[model samples]
Target: MKPRSLVSQSPTSLKLTTGCEALDACLRGGFPCNSLTEIVAESGCGKTQLCLQLSLRAQLPISNGGLNGSSLYLHSELPFPFRRLHQLSKSFHLSNPNIYADHNDNPCDHVFVQNVHSVDHLLDVMPKIDSFVKSSRTRLPLKLIVLDSVAALFRSEFENTPGDLRKRSSLFFKVSGKLKRLADRFGLVVVITNQVTDFVESSDGLSGLRIGNLRGLYSSGRRVVPALGLAWANCVNSRVFISRSGDGICEERREDDESGSSSVGRRDRRRFDIVFSPYLPASSCEFVITREGICGVG
Candidate 1:
């Protein structure tokens, strides 16, 4: 008789928190554990806020769709705004006093943060991040690892010439593959933020500009091309886009004819749209960001 096979069944389910019930439903519970997910968008589009919220949500218990683990937040361009993070944490009711008590302890002991500006620096720091995760005393599974804007590395490290583009593209692919492997080995959710470039076409029939040359050129297009182009989207399991929309102005009007003397001012509320997803239907939902956190709006 042939020897019995040793392989066992894979886990049938994985749970995660989308930071909002509606989003969780859309995601069919949450993002897959031990996988990579890309969240790409332009500035002021709630990308960082979503990441911060997810980091807090990861601390919740497994039954609540969280990983019951810690998080690692890597910053590429801007340092983390502690004040904003604190405010958001308060809004979400996720503040932990104990984690703040020990000021001298390594930040990786629970929630870790690292600042890396260049691709070379990020490559150098990867081993250190692995070491920190391995040395945690609590043995709390690291549920989330976030790279706040991965495109910054490429933009800063590589030139725009064809040779440099090819070289950088290959490097990014290799690095992304390594990250995927790391997530699988550690059973952690890896979230990467990416910046986008505009796909412009001039009237003369030119094949779009290679690079824009103007003030605020980087913010012209939605941050999807860099995040989702060149097989990058295929490497990750899911993608999300967040954007804001409003009337951009406020006006005053009388609420009722009876109250002739009083005028009411109406400020348009912000809107949240889910532009794309792999596991959920393509639909948009309205939400408001308030002191109570992200709440569904009619």
Candidate 2:
């Protein structure tokens, strides 16, 4: 019998492009497979937008920086934004026509959207995902699994009591372990979104800042920390942050300036930061959300 080679057994080397050149470069190719990546940010900071773009891009061929597979999006927030996804798919398919020439087919159809109600609901659903991935019903191989927002699942379910906190932490490990296992076993890229909470300073005025990294997290002119606290933070393999500044100038600065732009109105300037990652150094880049999709701004 032939022996298995190291390269053939290792799945961690694979990656899925984020569909943006600048953001891809910052992430050292893109979100790595065989790992659990947490995208953290405040509301309306383009977290879901990025995840939606990734779901579409994951369907492209590997040569084009895609996994040539399907994605499972488990949303715990608002109803799955099918309308927004339709818009993104139209632009994505148009941009990559060589591979999508017969683009009459809808890409959104390939993305499976599931609504998760709460922590208990998610736990019940977690074990079934393994079977879903192996089933022959799916048209394409599953390469990515996205949980729209992990924070929402556990947000109001737990109290400040020690027993409740410990239980919540245990659940965090269970969910993360299953996600990481799926990623490792199937070479799937798991990306989970996390909401943020206000960062209140302690008596010494510095304890809160030490949560994830030395710099700390701030967004929209206010200091905030990723929800679910430190116990949950330690579960994921990587953490990425997206922040929005409300006073940002429009993407077309020259046009806005020339139009004497009070009528132009300001847009939020969003930034993506690699808070911590085993394969990447801490870094960030500015990005914008447009009709096409989310893209890095140089």
Candidate 3:
């Protein structure tokens, strides 16, 4: 073989469009294939909304910035939002009429969902996905694998003791390893959502290792950080954060008012930030959740 330096450049990894222009731009294209991306956020900040949009976006043709494939969503808690998904499907179809013009199938029908109740259940499910993708019966190639929330299974499964912590970290590696293998084998884009906990400032240096933008882990004027600590942080290739902030303004405020304020209303102003990523710098953009879907604001 020729020396390593003389080898040809590798092909660029595939990216799945987020369907939001500003957010997509901030992501420097979109969520990348062959890597694990973590979406960290507090409750009610549109984490699931963004994931729902991606499920539909993945079905678009490759020319339209999609993978032209299907998505598998492994949700850890709560019922799958079938009704909301149907609503977004309508919006997605309207947004891309030409893409679906030749086909009559519902895009929402293509998203496969499974609830993972515990750590064991998730571990059991991961190995089987490889076979599912390779099965000839699958009509569409799988491009996206989303774990709606990774923190739920571990929240109560392990205690804070040293032995349990080691076990928890070991399990983390197992799941991430399998996901990475699948990503590399199939050029898949894996997106995992994580819950956030209130950050408690400690003089000890251990707390300083928490990840976020350079300004620290404050969201919505309150300090918060992704759950599962640093052990889980090392498992992913990228981390994106979603947050909300506002005063008493109406939640449905359409645009920035005459007061020259960017915020909508109470809990209306939402922001998306790149906490850390191998391919993207720490950047941020604003976004809104409308009846249609999540759209990035200027």
Candidate 4:
């Protein structure tokens, strides 16, 4: 019998670059492919915007620390923000038509966007997503798969009734398991956005009542929240919390004072906190959304 070559048994790893030099350096590359990443935050926290930027960045060539593949943006609550995507693309100076163009010569040919409002619709579209990955021949890899706000589908579909708590939790476990398998088979970075729910004390005092806060309210009482609870956090490899800080005015004044000067001035800052990670930095960094690209705001 012939001996197996060492190369045949070795496992290869895919590491994506985040497009932010500092962040990429800290991550030792970017998000790992074939893994699930969670980004959680409240409304107006710039989670969606960061996801959009990452989606665009994932299509660059490998020399530039990208997979040069297509991105699938699955928006559960809203339409695709095409204008924001275009603006970011222009700012990054990502002018490679081969990376963005389709067979028919469209600029955004590689970017696929879908809005899924219902859990049933999401399930129905599973096969299509798989087909896209398989048909791409893995040469033009499917770099990223994003589910913007997974909590929406669960909250709307499950309702988190007292009687259905066990059933709903079981269903979420199954769904999350399938998502993990999908990421492994396709060699893509799977990103899921989640909304937080308040943990309240229960009448029995043994366990607490969990309330979904999609609109940022905890008034309507529910026995359990529909967000898959702790299981959701455990299923993903990393989690990022994005939030806004400081008014834009402070930076405006600094910019005005530093006009015609080359010194770096105060700028409106957005925070990207690495809240959870298995192998990355845990510190928060300030950044600014610019007409060109996302830059560190010192």
The CA lDDT of each predicted structure is 0.63, 0.84, 0.84, 0.67
Predicted structure with the largest TM-score when compared to the true one: 3
Q: Which stretches of candidate 3 lie over 4 Å from their true place?
A: 1-11, 98-103, 210-212, 246-263
Measured against the true structure, the TM-scores of the candidates, in listed sequence, are 0.75, 0.89, 0.90, 0.76
- Worst 10-residue lDDT window, candidate 3: 246-255
Give the higher-TM-score candidate: 1 or 2.
Answer: 2
Model 3 deviation from native, Cα RMSD in Å:
3.3
Instruction: State the lDDT of candidate 4 residue by residue for 1-298, as single tens digits.
Output: 9974757633545667766776566566777787888877666556687777778777787788877777889998776778888777665544555654454343355568898887678877777888877877644567788899888888766655775766666666666677778887877888888875555566875334322212222212222222456556566778765555444556666677768663433334556666567776656666666665566665
Rate residue 144 of model 2 by lDDT: 91
Which candidate, 1 or 4, would have the higher lDDT against the true structure?
Answer: 4
Clashing pairs in 4: 91-292
Give per-residue CA lDDT, model 3, range 1-298, as digits (tens): 7564423645556799898899989988899989999999998889999999898899888888998899999998688888989999997888788765666667876799999999899989988998889983645699999998899888879999999999999999998999999998888999999998888777886666646565567677787878998999999999998887734345435445545565445466578889889889888888888888888776
Question: What TM value does model 3 have?
Answer: 0.90
- Across 86-198, the per-residue lDDT of candidate 2 in tens digits comes to 99988887777665456555677679889998988888887788888888376679899999999999988899899999999999999998888889888899999999999
Off by over 4 Å in 2: 1-12, 97-104, 204-214, 246-267
> Which is better, 3 or 4, measured by TM-score?
3
Question: Candidate 1's residue-wise lDDT over 124-181, tens digit each?
Answer: 8777767766876654667788889887777776677889877877777777877787
lDDT of 2: 0.84
For residue 98, model 2's alpha carbon misses the true position, in angstroms, by: 5.7
